[model samples]
Target chain A: MTTTALKARKEFGKTLASDIAHRLRNEIVTCQLKPNESLKFDALRLSFGASFTTLREALTLLAAEGLVVAEEQRGYKVAPVTLEDLHDLTHARILIEVDLMRRSIEKGDDDWEIRVISSLHRLARIEERAPEDYASNTEWKAAHRQFHEALVSASGSPTLLAVRNSLFDRAERYRNLSAMFRPHPRDKAGEHRALMQAAIGRNADQACNLIASHIQTTSNNVAKYASGVISAG
Target chain B: MTTTALKARKEFGKTLASDIAHRLRNEIVTCQLKPNESLKFDALRLSFGASFTTLREALTLLAAEGLVVAEEQRGYKVAPVTLEDLHDLTHARILIEVDLMRRSIEKGDDDWEIRVISSLHRLARIEERAPEDYASNTEWKAAHRQFHEALVSASGSPTLLAVRNSLFDRAERYRNLSAMFRPHPRDKAGEHRALMQAAIGRNADQACNLIASHIQTTSNNVAKYASGVISAG
Candidate 1:
């Protein structure tokens, strides 16, 4: 084959591998794959209808993101969750998030402010439409993520934003698990509104403090539910 | 094969993959593998005497660590260094390290204190022996890492520590590059000694400020040298 043809084939292979990884990532985070379950290559090949090479590449990508664990002899497994890990994750998130928010408030322009307000409005609408509907929970979660991202979008440091994004994804997985096992009723909408207000008012200290408490409450709830789920299992 | 035998074989494969990853990580950070250089699998497989599968797994792990970039059709390449990225990295490190130091000071036990002193002593001795000996630079780098790790060992938060570790490794690469290109001399020993003294005195504010400045100075120097190197190349 000519060099151009070879290059094209390689590019296609990479895109396919990435697509597989993205699908698997979604499944793992949504708990469809279940934590700690070994990802047998043959089974994944059959399920995804991809070659071993493609599946292996996909798994490796997920492993890099900490969504999957590359077991020494056992191939890969969906990363397990625990109360301690959840607490630690939450703690780190609070630190990075609050710091980013403070920077965002200090440096964010009008565009950043508008995005935050719009995201909050969208999130509130989603929650109001179906706060407890499992069918629409995914939409609500997406909106929630957007709202949080918007609040800190003006940090202007890609490194901080990247760290915040990773932590947010990890927390999202636990949040999803929490909703699954224990459907607790809480004033999430009210809390987010207050967070938005504080951020918009340029009250960095108050906004950060509110975010800390906001994250802490969710973590406590998730931890309580996660433990119960583990014990029952 | 029986289940046990099959498991053993799988374990060996995983170990081989991990070993390859470790070897590549060292090379990338030390600039043995130049940045933006494509990691052609065929060549790597030949050089490492490993199969394509094993080599690919290794590259993916490095990619996950941000030391390597997995290109679409071109395969993997060592991540390129830029002054902007370096600055962002330093900023993130300052925030995390200082916060961690504050916590460490508040909670570090006597054992933690002893470890910090020991690490500092070892690092100081290494610097004094050969401040400019490129041959033993790796040893010096390891000592420097240990000293920093020891200072924050009492943070009591694994997540924060993990993030800090990743950022530290990234910065280490830039430092190595800076030394290779510029080879400037500085009072690194004095700075580290003062840092250790502040921590040992339980002066959180002073220690944190010192660390922030220490990191900033290195970053500034590295940036200046890195830009020159890049332009020269």
Candidate 2:
């Protein structure tokens, strides 16, 4: 094979795998593929317009991010979203993220605070409604994700942020799915404002405590909502 | 495929994937693949004597646990080991683990204390050599991992335990790779004994501090050793 041909083929494979990866990540994160739904290679090949190898490569990336589960023979599935998982995920999130916020408050500069404030502004403006159901709006989902990511981006520890992001991604599916069954009335905007106020003021203890309570409140709310459905079913 | 034929095929796939998963996991944890080694698919398939489907499935499982990284076109690679990563991983471990030890002290049963003591006794029995050349000793590695796991198994949080196990698996490769560097005089067994004593005596603060220092000391030693080689390279 010519060098040019080999290089072209490599580029093609790279683009194909990444394209497939982006589509699969969005599908799992947004629940286009329902929880515990099996992913078949043959069907995915036709749908994704890729070969078995390309599709598996994409799935491997998703699996690394905890957005998908791969079973030996059963094939890949959207990772099961459970109340217990939500509770644990949130607890771990608080454990890592609150510390991150504390560190960020200690080390974050004006630019970091600016980023946090901007993300909060965006979140406050977003409409929070059911993501599905035609007339429903949940631009809040995207805004909420941005706000949380911004909170830790200043943590300055790449591994901490990376693990935090993974936990957040996994928690998102459960959060959206259970949102329809349960609506939170408490002022999320207020919580964000207080969190920002504390962090901007460089009050690490208050910021840490607020973040912990904020996470705990969401965990309790989601767990109650999800368990209610299981019993009802 | 016919129904019976389909069922048989699935069984075969399941066994093959699972077997590869088990072997691959051990190979990784034991540092057989080495840190940052390229995992070309064809080579892995040949090494494992498995089909592409089976190998992909196994790699997916490892990827989920953060033991390996998947590249878009290049294929999988053993996750890299670095001092920065070790520092972050160690800090995260200490945070979760110290909290866990405290919880175990507060909530642990007599059996829990006994198990901790037993693990300490076993760990104390193992000879501490220069890990530089001892990285390949299978028996020593197994005993070391078991000792650490047994300490926190009484924490009563499966999620926490699972995350801890995952971090430890990733750190082992760095530990092995860094082992080939200079030796530092560290109290290899005394630290474990002190931690165990404090825990059994219900000295939460002492136990927590000991564990934290214990982990950081090793991190510092490994960092000192790796920096020279890493910079030279």
Candidate 3:
């Protein structure tokens, strides 16, 4: 093969690996793959219609992101959920997210303000829709992530943002798990609006306080429901 | 094979993969593997006496730790350093480390205090041996890491420590790079002593202030040297 042909093949392989990782990540986070369940290589390859190399690469990537755990000779398994993990994750998230919000308030420009507002609007609209509708729930989750991302977009620190993003994703898995077990009625809309108002008002102290409480409340709810589910199972 | 024999073989594979990852991580952080240089799998497999699968898994693990970067089409490469990265890293470190130190002071027991003093003693001894000796420098780095780790060991948050450890390793790479380009004389020993004093005194604010300044001074120096090294290269 010519150099160009080899390069194209390599590129295709990389893309294929990334695509498979994305799909697998979604499955794991949505609990479709189920937590703590062993992931058999041959089964995953057949299910994803991917080559062995591609599937292995995808799993390795997920393992790096903590969505999957690489076992010795046992192959990979979906990362398990526990209250301790959630507590640690929540504590770390509060630290990073609060700091990022403070920096964002100090450095965020008009664009950042607009992004926050737009995300808030979108999320509120989705919340008004059927809260139990799976599709709308997914949309709500995405909008929620967008709003949080916008809140920290102007932290002007890539490292902070990256750390915050990772913590956010981990916490998300627990949140999703909790949602499945117990659909509690809460005024999420009011809380988010308060958060938005503080952020836009450029009250770093208030914003940080709001965010901490917001995260802690969700964490408490998730912990309660997740424990119930685990104990019942 | 018997079940025990099969288990042993599986354990061996896991150990080999972990060993390779550890060795590669050291090389990357120490600049034995140059930053941004492509990690050719064939070359690495030949050098490490490992199979392609083992080597890939090792690389994937390092990529997760941010010690290596996985590029599309291209393969893994040592994560590169830039001024922007340094700034962001330092900022995040200050936020996390200071908060951790505060918690450590508030929550630390006598044992934690003993560990901090012990680590400081070891580091100070190492510093006195040879501040610039290449062979002893590695020992100094290890001791330094230990001292800092001890300072935050009482934070009581595993997630915080994990994030802090990753950031610490990345910063070490930059410090190593700066040491190569420019060796400035600073009373690092005294700074560390003051830091230790504050911590033992249970003065959270003072300890945090000392650490923040200490980190900032090193950051500024490293930034100055790193920019010159990059530009010259």
Candidate 4:
């Protein structure tokens, strides 16, 4: 191939790989792909209409995000969810995310507040259903992520946000598992509204407290339910 | 190729890629590769005796670790070191590593204590010279890293340790920069000995404080010296 065509083709490959990674990430996070499931390339290639190289690249991205596990001399598997994993993720989030939220409250401008209000509205409008029902509800999932991210949008530290985001994405599987076994519907809207008020009101302590509880509650529910279904150690 | 030959070739490629990745990681972290310097494929291929495919695979791995930045169609560069990045990494280490050290102290058994003492001894035996000298001193670097990791090896949470490890590594580049511009050599050994005493003594609060200060001191020194060197934004 000519240099120009080769460069263009390489760019196309990068975009295609990223697109496939996003698709696979959503599936894995929502439990549609399921935990500890082997991700055979042939099946994934057929499903995504991607080449082997593209599929491998996509899996590499997911592996970096901790959503997929790459084994030496073996293929990839969806990362397993365990009670210990959930607790670790929860503790990291409480420490990092709460600090981010406090910083956001201290540093945020009017635009950040506006984003918090609007994202919350978007999420509040979506129906918060059970895990099985919401598994395919990408819109609600996106809105929920936006709302949480918007709260800390002005933390002004890209590294902190990236760390917070990875922990958030890794914990998502457990949230689905938690919802799957929840005996009663959580008043997520109410909780989010409280968090939003505290954040915009500049009550950093209260905002941090609410987010910690919000994280801890999901963690508790997941451990209570998933302990029996997955590895305890 | 036969199926077995193909499988063997694939396994060989994986190992070669990982080896290249490690080599590149050490160079980038130690700043031998230099921050924001272009990593052209042809030069890297010649230098590492790697094929284009193998080099790309290695770059992908380094990208996952935040040591390499891949530009679409253009190739890669060593990840940049900015004051903001240093602060973000240092803040992360303070919160996460201190927490890990605290937990390791609480949960660590006799082996953890022995490892900490031995690693400290190993580190102290080596010369903690200037950055330019220590840049080539992989032994001292390895011992230093082992000493810190050993202090938190029993945090009982793989996820937490993984996060801590990443933060620690990303901060390494800045530590080298800090040492490069130091007006006087720091008593890192003394600080580390104190930290070890606090950790093995089960004084979580003291250990955490020592680590936070050690991390903060490096961060402040780097900011003071390198403020005029790199990107401010």
> Estimated TM-score per prediction?
0.87, 0.80, 0.87, 0.89
Off by over 4 Å in 4: A1-14, A128-136, A181-184, B1-14, B128-136, B180-184
Model 1 per-residue lDDT tens digits across residues B1-233: 56795445334234877777777888888888988888988889877778987788788777767788887767789888887778778999999999899999999999999999999999888877886763237788789899999999998888789778878888888888887767565568888899999999999999999999999999998888778654332
lDDT of 2 by residue, B1-233 (tens): 56795445334335666667767877886677776788887899788777876687677668767777888556788776666677778878887888677777888887887788776666555554434433456666777787777777777665567777877777776666567675644546677778878888889899899988887887787777767644232
What is candidate 1's lDDT per residue for A64-156, written digit by digit as tens? Answer: 666788876668898888777787788889989989999999998999999999999988787767767532277877888899999999988
Residue pairs whose backbone atoms clash in candidate 4? none
TM-score of chain A of each: 0.88, 0.83, 0.88, 0.87
Clash pairs for candidate 1: A73-B11
Cα lDDT, all candidates: 0.83, 0.73, 0.83, 0.81
The residue-by-residue lDDT of candidate 2 on A1-233, one tens digit each, is 66796445334335666667777877777678887788999989888778987788678768767787877556788777765667667777888898789878888888898889998887765633332332124467677778877777787776667778878877766666666677554456778889889989888899899999988887777677767543222
User: For candidate 4, what is the lDDT?
Assistant: 0.81
Per-residue error for B83 in candidate 2, Å, reads 2.7
Q: Model 2, stretches more than 4 Å misplaced?
A: A1-71, A74-78, A127-138, A183-185, A231-233, B1-34, B51-67, B128-136, B183-185, B231-233
Compared with the true structure, what per-residue lDDT tens digits does model 4 show for residues A112-225? Answer: 999999999877767644443543367887888999999999998777787788888888877776666666655577889999999999999999999999999877877887
